[model samples]
Target chain A: MNPEMLTKWLIRWGGTAAMIAVLTAGAGDGVAQESVAVRAALVTGTLPLDDPNAAAWNNAAPAVFPMSPQVHWPERIQQVTVQDLTVRALHDGTQIAVLLEYADPTEDPDDAAAIEFMVGDKKAHFAHGQPMLLVEGGPVNIWYWKSKDNKGVDLWAKGFGTLRPHEHQDVKAKGEYANGKWRVVFSRSLATDHPDEDAQITPGQFINIAFAVWDGRKDDAGQVIEKGSQKAVSSWWYFRAEPPPDYSGYVYAGVAAVLALGFQFVLIRKLKEGQSA
Target chain B: MGRALIRPIVIMGAMYAFLKFVLPNIPGSAEIPASLIILYLLLTLSGIIIFETLSAESKDAFWGPMQRFLTGENIGGLQPLRYGILVLFPVLVGWQTYNATAPSDSPPAENRVIHPAPPGEYTGLANPVPKTPENIMQGKGFYAAFCSPCHGANFDGKGPAARGYNPPPANFADPTTIAMLQESYLFWRIKKGGVGLPIEGMPWKSAMPRWELELPDEWIWKIIMGEYDGAHQTPRTWE
Candidate 1:
């Protein structure tokens, strides 16, 4: 065969092999996330404030976020007691409620969980908020719940070791332990009276959120373990109240298609003129 | 002539699929930035266009079908194909534009130097500790206590604390990371941590704790060796 024919054969076989490789490999888009946004499904009537196994929760989608040990600060846990937390959210126009469920074999007195949201426009660091000296916008609104109290406290924090209860305690919570799992519900108003201290939940908008859990265990002597910053925590995730479907995206897509077709017509006219010439 | 017209498109599409999809799925492979992928495709397309149009015969071979299609010439039995192209091309363009312009919650693209130049003083410094088995064992213990929380017990940078970190921890198992850097550079990085990065490493939000304050210099060297052993990688030689 001639050199040109040999080159053609090589190209043909090489192209076929590459096509096969691509097809067999499959299109695996490796964009992995630890947790998806916890969408608060819109519901009518009263929200499930205290019911963990309520039938209404089936309407909301569940998202499980992997929890890590709080190892950044001096008081940190070396071993992770809680591996992950399953979260579901629901909104009743007036109030928003979130259910946090995690697995723990023992129910010590210190078994507690908390959900936090960014208080300002700027995002703070997810782990215990950001240091105030280094940067601004580190304030967070925390809804803290404990099994011992069976209640939730509305708290605020600017950074590590700065957690303080808010003057207006607007958050409420209930907890139930069954089947070796702790299910806690934290509920608050969608629009709080104190926006400065609380993270106002707006429909159709995403808000930065994080979670922390303290798994208390007792020794043979029945002494409660020290559970402070040494707890299982999750990085920043998103919480958004599901909004009604809008048709704006379809309109934008239609306009773009029309513009592209118009450009193609101009290209066809240019090609026709060239052919005539 | 028809084959020539489709060859370049096929090549471009295959390359895009490989870069955007196949590469990331490969174990121990870092993600190729979308901007870098676009740059590569543009360069490949430009080269192909220039080569195809180098001669009159080749130019005719390459553009003849395109010209005919646009001008609606000699499309005799290809009426359905012509209509299909007319509908699909605009829709494809619209879909691509929507994907590019749509709002997403994913973080914005970041451009930062991964391995910046070490300072002159640290460049000549060598590991003070010898690579003994006992020392390595000690280093492994220290790593489990100090580094494993974020760098991971397996040295793959997926430690439990690694979530939500924008840059994440460095995966030593990847050849592009520790295997590519000199031991001195690793020493400086470990000693100074993220706060010690130069201006080129801006937006320095790395959660790496500075070990110089807590660990001895000899222990740091041992930990470096331990990291290499854990990741099954060797430090880059000066030679």
Candidate 2:
């Protein structure tokens, strides 16, 4: 057997193999990549995070980072600091969420946590046991705020497994913002059959929310609204995406392409020999 | 037989690498970075390679390399650029597909356009909303009624409540020389509220009902444009 003939076989196999490999990998990823649609639009919302008595202005809340209901990846909220703080409620028809932002949470020398908010002029607090009201029925939202900060470990509220309230599951969360404040939203997602239900939502609803953040404590001097001096919630909004498809299609298509290409190559080779004869 | 098998393997590796950069950027793709592509490729490549190695081809060889491989339609004399362009085929297809499907943002929520306020001092209105001489003075009044509390009287963003706010009020008088916004810029900001600006930590309009409702459009314009302008302090005439 000639080594030169063997070398020729090797290169022929190598070149064909490379093209096959490229198509296989290319098609698989291409199919998967094509399914996705990427987007990044500037999302802005405001929430209150300051003391009631510390008065220069109490009405307006600045735009907060890590805005509401978007689940915060474990320690992702403490990335910013707040010089002054404010909190505003955002009411998406079904529920209320919060958005928080702050002074350079990245560059600060203070004792303040990454996120904080004043509920009734006192530091707002939430944990596993508390329950905060989400809406007043004044406004309607298209979708609820799921966790916006998706950590690698989990699919978070919307994409992966959700904390569905089969009976009375504890749904507790603390909203930290790029601003320096840790706000806790501890609520329980009651059962679907529960009577206290405001409204049920199909998977993909609108994401607009309008919050009515008030002192939840007492009212100041002159104000028409029910609660405290300065109170307003952030605008409403939601996010949605169609997930990627399964890979079974790739397997079948790949198998067929290879088989067909092989059969055709063989048929052509035989036909060439037959013509020569 | 051998070439066909190699095709999928190498293609898979390169494809894995390229897609790694693409996926994580898909909006909310769990901040997982691109380096993870290498990890997935390693784990997947090994498994795939193992699977293919056991199933080698069972056929005799075909024509040798010396036997000319030609285009039947036109005895093939294609240019290098042609091949180069073909090489870029996958990349171009991927990019075009992304562009078509990717979510381009909605035109920034019809920005708050500040229609020149009704003839006030700036407009020199007959009502002369406030008794101030300059719109800057009216801006002071306008801000005092609204913005100054959180932002501060001097626009130092040091209002009395300035002590504990996340993203303190923007220092309008920052001597540091920031965005040299135009005359009507402040009015647009004030009226539109902070629907999408960097006044983080404070709620939009900060309880000052969309000034569109609270102040006559004129006053909101006077307060923001007048008092916030650099003309009084920096000596540069309002361009």
Candidate 3:
């Protein structure tokens, strides 16, 4: 083929194809941002609170993620034993509940655990050492649990290192250890008066959450080190909440637009030929 | 000479503009960065010009000057122009590519200086182990386990964990890098590590751990030797 004719044909077809792809891919950009998709199960009845073998959780697929050792204090620890964690979530119109389960060879006598939730639209750094509640700007809600105290506390933070317990707790937690595995549940209302302070989790919207777990058994010299400071004492991972059923309409629209452009280009070329003749 | 360059230079410049302005915004297209597009266009066009000049039709253009002047005969007016372009075009494209892509050979800036000169005992310390096949093999094993995680298996600064660090790990493959330092200099750096590196900017930010805490003095020397021999890189010399 003549180089000029070949170049012209290549440009027209290639440009049209490229335009269609970019528009289609750009439309579903938000869907791509979600790292973890926790399906919001349509629970018609009461959620099983105490039952470990609940059927509602059967539909909720587990998202197993690895824990990364804290990077801040490289001198304190070189490696961490707690490597894997599996999480599942379900929602009943009014409340959202998440189940976090992880394996531990030896359950510490302290049996202490903490989970943090950030309630905003902005992307989170989920950095190590500093409290994520502080790294997440506006407000973050934290739930702290200890088996020795037999109590869980709800805390709030607004900046880098500021963490304070709320006068009233907003999170309820129940935990159990069986066969060297720890399963804990955290549940809260869909809507709350302190929307600013509480993470307003709703179906179909994606929000960022950071996880930190401390194994008291791994502590050195009776000093239980966890949270903030990248060491074996603490570990962090970032998970973005995604609702069930993938909806990508932009990709379809992009295909339709490309077809229309191709049709129009042919029509225009025919008209130009007729006028020249 | 100036007149002979006009056509090729203009064509190259236009090709650059086409790649930079028109290519990046094309949807569904491989969106190469503007700088990369320019480099690609220059290299390609220069290659084509050279390839086309080598053909039978352009033979007079390449050898015209020698044939015409020696025979005392005036051939076509195109021979001088073709010879000039054939001689100059490749050098121009090669120089541009080298300038754009090659690593800067200048010494590190003041703020980037991780460690200064050695004080007393570390000045002339040499590697105790001879560069026998066994010792080099052991050094290679140790380096793969430790240094390769951040310094990269190829001794480039692009290891898996090297991404987030502020100042990236040293690339041993760079000729100006480890090739400039002595064995004793490396020994001090390995023993004292980043802690010995004084706080100039953000202190304690050095990702390098003091190997003294992790490995003995013998292994450090072995790692240095293995890197030079294994990667086949030129060692730094007093000369």
Candidate 4:
């Protein structure tokens, strides 16, 4: 075949294939719809390691989410104990840090506070266990922080009561209580190769995240200290990671489309004589 | 055969892409900006028009068989079909052009009249705390924590999350918005929230969550004081 004929066939088939690929990849059906949307603002400057008062976090956007009581067996509570949760996240390419601030009537002596955040593949289902909150059949990473402990425990679990401590501790947390409120900061690397940790975060991509708060208040009896009970469990939500500095996905899409059209037009002109074929 | 398949594939594929990838990604729900859809539709329609103009004879090759089947065994039966196509084609083009160029702030059918009335219990209620500079500053902090995500830092209804909500959060700056409503009404709305909205019109679809138990009464009142003072706009009742 001549160069003209070869080019025309290539354009015709190539354009059709390209369009199909773009449509299928972009249409993510199983991804959970955002019940709550959190925007993790991009910060280029360095953040204070292991400290909450980082200058880089000053300009971060704050997201406030409602904390409802965990109404399930062994931990059923009719009334919501906690009121609201305000969160802010900042990333400077190397690390992603989250700051959470919420009001607590009084600080519990035994356990100050705890936070559990789940992040994994978009297709993964977030299951709230009747006895505990955990996903079924694996791939849920839980970061548990307690005020009394020097460091927090990272765990990987699949189902109810299946949680096992992670091989290595990856998440660092700090908690400060003052003026009837607790402010906590959690930080970790943006991406990691750890088997138990699914830390793949990219700009413009949505990831499912939910939070559980544990208030360590005790009842009248000293034996009844709910040392680490989840007082509130939030519904599944999503946060789109800050897009890269050169975020031009739309521009690329536009240019690719225009080139596809130009290629189609050229092929049509060249194959006009073969139209009857 | 190859030429015939290519155009349909491209057209349908492009439409699929627009509906799937483009439409869902556009910021708002009920307030979907028509400009993007309009542009895509116009471009696809123009592509068809260009192709039809170029392949006048071949145009019949695709449409002729279907047209014949639709008007089978009837003399001059295709006249209505041709006339119908001729009339509807321009109407579709004109509608798309209007939507593409129309102002986004234009109210929806249900937004024609959305005046909310406070309940009897809440009618006479007012902020008990005095609005000192410190109180106003504290109110600003509460507003930033709870309301700023949707209502915006300046209460302009252009917050980051505001783009995702329909009937985007009320703009306190607008004369017809909080400026016209009393503090009692604002209090009731914040406490009861979207669920408390009158069951009439599109008000029921509001995404505003009830903050009654979540936010303290002091903070709620403070937010009201802070918003009006910070924005330099007076609340309706204070006048």
Query: Cα lDDT for residue A261, model 1?
Result: 99
Query: Which ranges of candidate 1 are over 4 A from the true structure?
Result: A1-34, A44-46, A92-94, A121-123, A132-137, A190-197, A200-205, A255-277, B1-141, B148-174, B183-213, B216-218, B225-239
Which candidate number has the best TM-score?
1
Q: Write the per-residue lDDT of candidate 1 for residues A37-122, one digit (tens) a residue.
A: 79898888678987877888888889888777776556666676788899999997788999999999888778999998988676
Candidate 3 per-residue lDDT, tens place, B1-239, comes to 23224555677788777776777678876667867876788697767568647877664454444444323345467668755654455445545544555443232233645445664777777789898999998999998877776678888876655543445577888777777778888787767654455434222334565678678989999998988886678566675
**Rank order (by lDDT, best first):** 1, 4, 3, 2
Angstrom error of the Cα, residue B45, model 1: value is 14
The candidate 2 chain B region of ten consecutive residues with least summed lDDT is: B64-73
Whole-structure CA lDDT of model 1: 0.81
In model 1, state the lDDT of residue A116.
88
Candidate 2 residues lying further than 4 Å off, grouped into runs, are A1-138, A141-206, A209-277, B1-91, B102-142, B156-207, B210-239
What is the C-alpha lDDT profile of model 2 across B177-204, one tens digit per residue? Answer: 2245444445544554433233221232
- In the range B166-200, model 1's lDDT, one tens digit per residue, is 45789999999999987888898888775566645
Model 4 residue runs over 4 Å out of place are A1-35, A111-137, A196-199, A223-230, A247-277, B1-239
Better of 2 and 4 by TM-score: 4
In terms of lDDT, the poorest run of 10 residues in model 4 chain A is A128-137
lDDT: which candidate is best?
1
True contacts kept of each: 0.29, 0.00, 0.00, 0.00
